[model samples]
Structure formats: structure tokens, C-alpha cells
Target: MIINPELDKLYNVRAAIPNHTDIFADWEQRSVEFSQNVKGQLDLRYGKGPREKLDLYLASEKNAPLHVFIHGGYWQAMDKSQSNFLGKTFLDAGINVAMIGYDLCPDVTLRELVEEIRRAFVWLWNHAEEYGYDQGKVQISGHSAGGHLVCMLLATNWLSYGLPTDVNPIHSAIAISGLFDLTQLVPTSINAKLGLELEEAKLLSPLFVDPQNICPLLLVVGSDESSGFHQQSDNLSVGWGENFEQLDRMNAVNCHHLSVVALLAEKQSSLFQWAIRHLGS
Candidate 1:
């Protein structure tokens, strides 16, 4: 049976054009207002290039665990400000939240974007102590494209950065409706902007990567999300086996990709509670 009616709306390789425009506009407006509410020091740095600046929202407490959240938009859309709503959950839980912004695709390659995220994580690691965060207690979470990035971070070699080989910068990862494999999207028009080749797709897919580290991972997906999204989560879970733990799926009570963030904003939600428990431990 058909699972995602929204996916049915797309006539060709292109996404449902109208929905894309509407969602992006909503994100832009939300991000603008969210930026205004940020208090304390906000560090903006061009870590990789002219456009590659990381925007960090520091919480009032210094000794709290840090939650690094990455935005979605299929790796081509969305901005850091659009995801500011996430700050409320972790902040209320007595944890500091870091929202990351990366250059969108078609302008910069996905490989470059992934590397940029890696660099941002390193920046966070180097500055963790100064920021009053426990580098050992860091948690990484992302939605959609961000979710893909979270998985990529999990697969990285911590030893290469002079960090402990046993130390995974990301102690726990909360990946919501993440796309783990780029190969599935090759047939879609997103590939036009993503510029994915077969070889590149295989190399970048987190599902294909080995999961040797045993980090607790929480994979969440809206019940109403597309079949492709569900498949992505399933593939990652299968690939990681026991290294992935505390797997929780949320139907989100009538939520879509955009609406899921509202659930995340609710500190009492399963996703938020699970993340807090993991980060606290």
C-alpha cells in the first residue's frame, strides 16, 4: 500500500514544488524571530569558507551538557535559525544547545558540507571546556539532512583529531527522520542540486559504513513521513545492529516533517526525555 500521500504529489524528479516553497518560507520567518530571542554570547565564525560560519547559542549555565542540533532541508535547504525552536527543550532540561548552519548544496558540494560539519564538531570539541560543557557528555542530534550528518559524525575517527580512540565526541545521537543513504535519492531531482554520483553515493552513505563504536542511538521518525524516510531509518538500524540502542519511533500524533520539530520542542516528549537521560549519563 502507499504510505506517503505527499510523495505522490510529486510528478517528476522534483519535490512537490509548492510545498517546498511554503516550508522554506516558514523556516525563514521562524529563524528570523528565533535569532532575536538568543541571549548571551553568540559566536559566529567562518570556520571553512566565506559562507561556512557556525552560529552557536549558549545557555546560561556553563556546566551543562551540550546538545548540537543540525537542521534538515534534504541537505540543500533550511538554515540554523530555522531550527532555533530546538533550544527550548534542551535549555529547559538544563543543557546548552548548539545550532549549526552549513552552506546549502548546488552552491557547495555535499562532500564539502559534510566536511564543514566535521569541522564544526571539531570546533565544538576544542572549545567544549571553555564553553562550560563536558566534552565527554556531548550529544549530537539532527533532523533529516542533519540526521544524516549526525550518523556521519558517529562513524568518524575520534583518534585522528588527537581525541581518545574510545571517546566518541557524540556520546549519543538522536536522529529523526534521517536520510542515511544518498543512493535512494539519485532518481529524484534533489540529485540535481546534490550532484551525487554512484561512487560518491556509496562512499557517503552512513548505512554502508561500519559501526564499530557502541554509542546509544535513538532513531525517530514521524509515522506520517514518507516511505523513503522510514526505509532510511530501518536501513541504519539494521546496519548498526546492537551498537544502536534505545531505538524509539514516534508517530508524532498527526505530525509531518515540519511538525515534528514541535514535538521536539516539548521537553516531555519521548525524544527529548530520552536525549536528556542519555546526555546526563
Candidate 2:
């Protein structure tokens, strides 16, 4: 194995330490408060059973595209409330946005979390008219773990769930800093708490799965992210080939893992503009 000291340092920060809860407390607090002010119906029910709530943020205008955002906390941390700030930009662009929350790992298996996301999409599809969405214009975007979920949604077979065979809930996807290959993470400390085995890792990996029905996808990473992250993005784009239609891999200059999200708010950024254009088309 080739070892680059600088690359190793980037991947080994204190935040990379396993099960570090307090590292993101401040940002989480800010996101919760920001979500509260967006003004929309909250925790609308999808499943009849417990733990089936989803927060909705409707656009002020009618017939808007619905953007569903999933927050990233390595599948063990963060909440929907902490990602409320994300809806504002889409809302401003006359698009509705939904920030979904799911049960975290250890408390719930990764398989369960994936089911929750799938249910969330089902709910969105069933209630698209109520939320002023076109249903056909829905898009999925997420960061890190959220990114992985979005890709999974893209790969899901709608026919198996009784939905229209050609209907993909996600018209396009913007996956930022996603972990497409879970096998590489199996040896990491985080895998212990996640309880991920080699077989499960391959099964859950978006990279390993056949990319048969993907929409236009944008794979983004921070210019300053670790080599592992950079590699993951490259691998997914290359693996998908034609299925990864209109691929745009961006390197947000001078940005790091956390700060790179700011580019989403900057309407001028190529990534942000590309997303808007895709949704508009």
C-alpha cells in the first residue's frame, strides 16, 4: 500500500475518531433552530406504525419540484431538524424541499434505515399533490451517508414496490462526499458500531450494484477532502459509465468536508447551477 503522510492526516482527524458525538453538537443545534423557522407542516405521517414521521417544507409557489434532502452523520448522528437550513435555497428557487430523518445505526440496523428512506419516498409520492410537487419532478440530494441513501433510492426497483415500473422518484441526484464502497470501510473503527460484515457491506454498496436505471447524477467532493473521498467519487463515476448520465465531478476549491456545503447556497457555483438547470429541464 502506498502511504502518503498528508493524505493519512486528512483522514485521521479527531472527527474521524469512532463514535464522536459531541464533535458536531454546535452545528446540529444551529440546524435545528434554522429548520424551525422555515414555516410548513411538520412530521406528516407516512407509516401507520411508530417512528414513521417526516418533516415537510413546501414551496410558496404551486407546481414546484420537490427536493428531498437527507442529512449525513455517518448513519449514527444528526437529525432532520439539523438540516433545515438546506431547504431555504430550494424554496427560494420555487422548489419544495423535504429533509428526512431516520433511526440511526446500532439503535437500528443499516438495513432498517434504508427501509425508512424508501418509505419516506413512498410517502412523498403518495402526497405529492398535497405538497405542491409534480411527483414526476422529484429530485434526491444528500451528503455523505445521505448521499449513499440517495444513490440507493436511484437504484431501487419501483416495480417491486408496486409503483410504476418506469417511474424513478428521483429525476436527478446530487451526491456529495458519499461513501459508495462500504467494503473499504469494513476495516475502519466506525464499522464496529455499525456492525457491518463483508457480505453486508458489498450488498449495501452502491458502487457494487449494477447502475441500470440511474438519472443524471452529479458526484461532488471538496477540493481539500481526503484521498479516500476523492477516490470514492472517481470510482462511482467510472463504474456507472453510461448510467451516470451527465456526470459532473466538482472540486470545490479551498473547501473541506463541512464547509463545502456552503457551495450549495451560492447560486453562482457550478454545482448549484447545474442542479437548478437539471431540475428546470
Candidate 3:
């Protein structure tokens, strides 16, 4: 870890949350129950890789917009199973939800994980008609490392991806408790797993990337989260101005890194409601 005491506290999410394990355990149990109870396609392969599968939960038989959610594990730890509960909010609102998973770092470079996410979107677009979703309306949301990946997706030019010019694959995006500038991460203990250099971090950071067609960019972080998370969201909103028609940030009240994500499961949560509104528009 870096010699900076404050930086260590800021970046070490598990250390910050003493009971993070229990939180995740509950998440796993709840996610399993949700998956068993909900009816939709499970373990759908988005890419050829073993880890590049996604779970899609459709609310109704009729067509609706799709909400693509990415799970965060600092690009290493978690998978989409813990994220299945997130789809309930969108499903209750009569929307389809797809939770994406990617190969972790060290095993596969972060760059390749980004490509896998792009390919996941490619799969979604190609299968939209079959899935009974509106291809043009996709609202992207991610937490932590997933947030970073969401920004990368936002910056992507769909035309280069062979997407139709008339159709917009991404309508709006939300980054929840995300780390935007990864340079700070390289010096932290997490770098052991991320294996990131300052140069590579800068190259992939949404802060530096030029966004393609700006959508409504919403940045969010738990108020009780470490200062690093708040600064990441604030800084990205300031830096990615050109990529968003309107920019906003939500300081989730009395929540931490893990708890803030719980807000996504709450129908009345400002964050969840905000996502629903933007997705409908």
C-alpha cells in the first residue's frame, strides 16, 4: 500500500466497512432467492468467455425498455448473482433488466473486461427483438468498478460498434459510488488485484475519455462513504460535461459503500426513481 495513511483509508472499502462480508453474504442469499422466484433467462451467454454471461429478468410478457446493470467488485471480486436483486425495482416498474458479469482482473486485463462489456451490449442489441425490449432505450447503471465501466460505455461511439445511427443504445447513465480516476487506485492496496499502472488507469478513466453523444449523466455516492468516492463522482461530473446534456449528483443520505447500493432495491429511493424516470424518457 502507499505510504499515505489517508489514501489507504479512502480506497480500502472492505476495511472501511467492518461487516462487509456479512453484507455480501446477505446479498448472496437474497440474490439466490430472487433468482429462484423470478422468471427470466438465467446464465445467458453474452460472449464466448465463461464469465461473460448475463441474467435478464423481464417484468411482463409485453415489450419494455431494458435497464443494463453492472456489478462492482473493484473489477475483481463480485459477480452478477449478487446483483440480481437490483432488477426487481425495474421489473416492478414494468421494465426488463439485464445484469452483466465480466472476467476479473489479473485473470484477464481490465481492458479486456471493458471489451467484454461492450460485447455484452452488442449481444443485447442483437437480441433486443427476441427479448421483447425497446432497442433504442437502454439506461446504464453501475456501482464502483461497474461505474467506471459504465462511463467507458458512455464514451463509446456506437457507430464504430456497428450500431445504427438512428438508434441510441445508451440513453442515460448513473455511476454509484464509482472510482472515476484510477490513478489513485494504483497506489492503494487494491492495486495488488487491479494490477494497474498510472498510465493504464488514465487511459481507461472516464475522466479523461471524450464522451461520444452526451446523455443525462447522473453521479451518485453515499454521503457516509469515504472521501475518495465523493471526489470521484464530483470530479467526473465536472470533467465529463461535454458528454451529458445535464449533469447531476446525489449524495445518498446516511449510507455507505454497500448500503447505498441497497437503495437500488428500494422502489421509493431517489436513485432508483431517478433511474426509472430517465429510462422512461
Candidate 4:
């Protein structure tokens, strides 16, 4: 696929951030340290696939709410290991945290990633009791590509997955620095491995899909990110308006794509406070 230079500039997050490498290194170092000390289970298999596993950290309180986080790598990069640092604040707040991992693109299609995530959630719901978390009090959050997955999960028909419609498993969701419209990525270099054609992109786009059940949804983007990202969040906020039981939006000040995820680590940030409030609601 031929890449569009302008579109590439708009969506290529690493190139946009001068200190992306440093940020990645910090995330890795912090995540590794966090994983070593946190009271949790690592690499818990949720499915038969090699990457269909999650790292779970339980709260001190019994039967606490579960806050599942999905890492973002444009659906082609990163994994659960780099995301463990995101669990600490929630864990300290007496909310159980789970960082999910899924197979990357080229090895697996975007559609497959969505399916695997749904399967992961089903596993979590089924085993919530054994893991000491309340299944009914589940909230989800994701960054970038993971944000796209969160929206996809919201659009999923729980009834088809053998879940009752009256009480959906997801109580609320937060998509930080999310890519909602896959169609915009098709011409860019980001879609090389994703191989998303126009029709498939539309089919996979969260903006085009209606939510299967009503749930509180929050859309967040970094103030310094490219217009493409801000548009993505704004478009979804408008497109999914009727589907969300409640909707909220935030622009993390002085932040870009990578730095926004760091706000979740900070206990006092508005992003953190807003997320915790909705998760508890």
C-alpha cells in the first residue's frame, strides 16, 4: 500500500513526539518494577492463543470493582508487559486491575483481535468470583489502539455471547487517545500491517457501529496531539451519542498521545480523577 505523507504525519504518533523513545523506556522500566512488587498474577491465560493472556492485580478490598485496561500500539505494537504500571493507582484505590494482551497485526487480523478481546472479557466475567472481583462492577479503559478496542467491545452484542441483555457486563468505559475511524488509517503507513481496506475499515470502525447496550462512555485526547486524533474522539462522541447512557469528553492539558497515558499513573490528574469517578459510578 502506498502511504500518504500528510496522512502519515497526522497518524504517526512516534514521529510526532521527540521523546517517544524515552517515554517507552520509562514505561517499560516502571511496568517491570510495578509487576515485581504488585500483589497480582502475571500472564494468566484467557484463551488458547499465545498472546491471549492478561496480568491481574487484585485490590485489598474483597470483591472490588474491576478496571480492565487495554494497551495501545495502533493494533500492531506493544503488549501487557509495558502496561502494568497503569494498574497501581487503581489497585491503591481498592479496584482490581487487569492488563490484557492480544496478538498483533500481520500475525492476526484486526477482526481477530476484537474477537480475542471479547473472549478475554468473557473469561474475566466467568472467573470473576474465583479471582475475587465483582463481575457486575466491571469498567474498561484503553489507550490509542486499545481505545478502539474498548469501543468495539461496547458495540458487541452481549446476547450473542451468551450474556443477558438486561445487565451488561460493562458499567463504564474510557478511551484515551483513541482511533475511532479506521478508514482514515487506510492510506497511511500505520495500516501496512493492519491491511485494512476501505470496506473492512468501515465495518471495523467504532464510529459506524451502534452500541449494543447503554453504558457510560468517556472520550479523551491529549491537547497536543494531531488534529486527526482530536477529530477521532470528537467524531465518536457525536456518533455514539445516543448509544451512551452518559457521555463525557476531556482534553488533557499540555499532553500528546504518549504523555496522556501517564496521566492515569498520576493520582491527582484530572484524567485520573475523572476515570476513577466513572469507574465507581
Candidate 5:
């Protein structure tokens, strides 16, 4: 399995490594187990639509820190249910995990998806008491398209959302193997589903946005990722400017875009443990 980093692998991760059944199988197996074995709420609606729902896994610690994970399916194909396995480790670390779902592309524009993400967090913050999670501190992490949405959330104006002005709803974030520049996808096969013209692509690209008021953010990409993927992660850190100095880093290491996020399933993996520290903060 010699993965050439410079190869012409497009944004579609599954295409690079066609045999991803094991990865998805492990996710499904773990997710189902965690969902059944753990005590949590499922299909909790944050918006009027049916797809705008979230799942929350509770931790032993009362008022535990919160972590929200968004699933990646290029904004069209996946659901929060597929990633419940992520909640297992966060729960063990005494952080509540909220897996959010959204209406997909074509049916709903990327702009609408962004608003859905914003509304999802706002719902979490407002209903923290019922969920038994701390509202004071929150961290976020997303893989692939989820990572893209994570950055938009980081750049969002919480105040405009009627969230507390004293503290940002998000305290820390990590975007794993995420696509930051939407324009890059315009010419790719994914664009057929995304339908992004140059203007729409630029308008939605988090890489081009300056997230000045955000908390600490870490951009990670797989060492075996395509050159385009690597470029996006690096550019995001640089675009953050001085904030990059605080947590300014882009981590590239063993795995491809798909496999990189699979590290989340390993409780002791560097990516998971590193995220645990962020939740503690």
C-alpha cells in the first residue's frame, strides 16, 4: 500500500483507496455498539426539519465539557449515526458528544448547511441544562466535509445567533483532513453534486475567511493525502495569522484522508488524546 502523496487523487477519498469497506465496517460496528451500550439521547431535533437532528452521549462527570462532531460525506452522503463510535472516547474523557446531522447538498445549498450547523450549536448551548453538559466550554472536531463545516462554525458570529457574548460557544477546534477551499472542488467530480460555481465556491471557502475571534484551531491532513489536500490545511493555518502562533499548526502524518480520521476510533491514538486535552481546556 504505497500511497504517493503527489498522485492525482481527487477529493473523493474512497476513490483513492477503493477497499474502504473495513474502515466503514469498523465505524458501523462501533457506532451501533456505542449507541446501544451507552445511555444517550438520539434524534434530538434542533431545527424544524427532520434531518436537522443530533445525538448526545452523556459522560459520568456532571456538567462535563462538550464536544460536537460533524460527520463528513462531502455534504451529501453521510449521517451522524455512522460516527457514534467517536462519542465513546469523548464520553470516557468526561466530555459529552453531540453528533449532528444536516440536510444534504442539491436538496439544500451549502449556505443552508452552514446555517443548520450554526443552529445546531445554538440549540446545544440553549439546552445544555436538559442535556446535562457544561455550556461554559466547548470544543469541536470534524472529518472531511465535517471539517469544512467545523471551520465555518469557528468563523461564525455567535452573538448574532443570540448566544452569550461573554464567551464564545466554541473554545477549541480541530479540522481533520478537511477541504477548506471550495473552489478547488468546482472542477472535481464532487461538483456535480455540489453544483458550485466559482463565486459560490469562494463564498463558502473557510480557507479564504479570516477567523480572527476564534479559539485555538488545529488543521490536520494525512501525510499520504494529495497535494491539494495538503495545501488547504497549510493555508488555513497561515490564514489564521497571529492566532496560528497560539495553536497555529497543521499536522501531517501516517494515513490518507479517509484513514487519517479513522484514528479517532483508536482511543489511545495521538489525534484522539490530543482532542481530549482540548476538551479539558
Candidate 6:
């Protein structure tokens, strides 16, 4: 493992959070219960890969705006199953929710994972009519690595992916506790699993990519998260300047990395309120 002391402390979230395992377990159990209790299509495949599946839950029988969520595990660890609970608040507010899944690293490169996410969106757009959602009113949000992916999605060239040049697949996006620049992580122990070379890391970083459109963006980081996460968000906002129609940044009070994302499950959370307002707009 690469042993850079400063970077390790800044990015090694699991090591810093003593109860991270407990948090994961709670998220898992709650998600499983929520999935069983909620009515939706489960394990719907978006791509041919075994892990390339998503779960969709609509607010009602009517056609509604869609909220797509991507789970974060540094691109190697979590699953959409742990993210199912996030759909409840949005669903309660009459928005349809889709939790996306992608093949993890070591099994597939990070670039491949990004392509899979893009493909998932394309699939969603193609099936929007059948699924009863508004194709034009889609918003996306992600936590941690998923947040990184959110920025990548913003940077995507939809036309190159076969979407018409006039169409914007994403209306707005939220990145929670996201890593924008990945070069710092290369020398850290976290890179041991990711296997990101220096050039690939730079190329994959959202900080370096030119955003494809001027969509609204919300950047959120936990108040108690490490300095590295705060730095990443700050850097990204500046780096992607003027590219987004609206760029708002927030700090989830008294919360750590994992706990901040849990705020989405709380109906009264500022995070959820902001989401509801933007999604309805």
C-alpha cells in the first residue's frame, strides 16, 4: 500500500470513522427492508454486465420526474441495495427514483464503470415512456465516489453517446461528499484497490474535464468529514466555474461522510428539501 501519511489521514474515511462498519450494516438492513416494503421494479438490467442493473420506484401511477442515485464505495465496494432507502423521501414527494448499479473496479476499470453509468442513463431515456416518467425532467445525485461519477456525468458528451445534440439528459445534479480530483488518492492506500495510474487518475478526474452543459450543480460535504473532502469540493466548484447555471455548496452539519448521505432519508433535512424544490422546478 502507498503510505502517504497526510493523504491517508485526509482520504482514509473508513479508518477515521470508528463505526463505519455499523453504518454500513444499518444502511444494508434498512435498504433490504425498504425494498421489500416498497413497490417497484427490482433488478432491472440496464447493461449486459452481471452487476449492471438498477431498481426503480415511482411515486404514483402518474408520470413523474425522475431522480437517479449512484452509490459510492470508492468505485469498489458498495451496492445499489444499500442505496434503496434513499428513494423513499423523493418517492414520498411524488418523484420517481432509480438506484443505479455498475461493475466495480478490479473487475472493470473505472473508465468502464463510467461508460456503464452513461449507458444506464441512455437506457433510462429510452424506457422513460414505458416506465411512465418524463424524459426531460431527470435529476441525479451521488455520494462519495458516486459524487465523483455525478461530475463525470455532467462532463459527458451526450451527443457522442447517441443522444441528440439538442437533448440534455440531466437537468441538475448533486454531489455529496464527492472526490473531484483523484490524483491525490493515487499515492494513498486507497489506490491499492483502485489501481489508478497517475495519468489515468488525472484523465478521470472531474476537475480536469470540461462540463458538457451548464446544468445546475449542488455540491455537499459533511461538516465533520476530513479536510480532503472539503478541499475536493472547493476545488471542483472553482475548477468547473461558469460551466453550471447554478452552483450551490452545502455542509451537512455535525455529520461525517457516511452520516451525511443518511440525511437524504430524513424528510425534513435541508438536503432533501433542496432536492424536492429543484426536482419540482
| Distance from true location, Cα of 192 in model 3, Å | 1.2
Q: Write the per-residue lDDT of candidate 1 for residues 30-81, one digit (tens) a residue.
A: 6666667656345467385655666566666776788889988778876777
Q: Mind giving the per-residue lDDT tens digits that candidate 4 earns over 1-281?
A: 88888989999898899899999999999988997787678789988888999988998788999999999999889988998898898888888999899999989999999999999898888889898998888999999999999999999998888887778899889999999999999999889899999999999999998888577888999999999999999999999887666889899999999999889999999988877897773
Query: Comparing 3 and 6 by lDDT, which wins?
Result: 6
Local accuracy of candidate 5 as per-residue lDDT tens digits, 98-158:
9999999888888998999999989998998887888877788899999999999877877
Compute the lDDT of residue 26 as modeled in candidate 2. 51
Report the C-alpha displacement of residue 20, candidate 5, in angstroms.
1.5
- Cα RMSD for candidates in order: 4.0, 3.7, 1.4, 1.1, 3.7, 1.1
**CA lDDT of each candidate?**
0.74, 0.77, 0.87, 0.90, 0.81, 0.90
- In order of appearance, the predictions have TM-scores of 0.87, 0.88, 0.96, 0.98, 0.93, 0.97
Better of 1 and 2 by TM-score: 2
- Where model 4 places Cα greater than 4 Å from the true spot, the runs are none
Residue 90 local lDDT, model 4? 88
Model 1 clash pairs are none
Which tens-of-lDDT digit does each residue in 1-281 have in candidate 3? 45456677798899989999999999998888887889879889988887999988886746688899999999988999888888887888988999998899889998899999999988998999998988777888999999999989987888878888775678888889988898878877778877877899899898888887577878999999988999999898888765566988899999999999889999999999899888773
TM-score winner, 1 or 6: 6
- TM-score, candidate 2, is 0.88
Per model, state how many residue pairs clash.
0, 0, 1, 0, 1, 0
Superior candidate under lDDT, 3 versus 4 = 4
Q: What lDDT score goes with residue 127 in model 3?
A: 94
Is candidate 3 or 4 superior in TM-score?
4
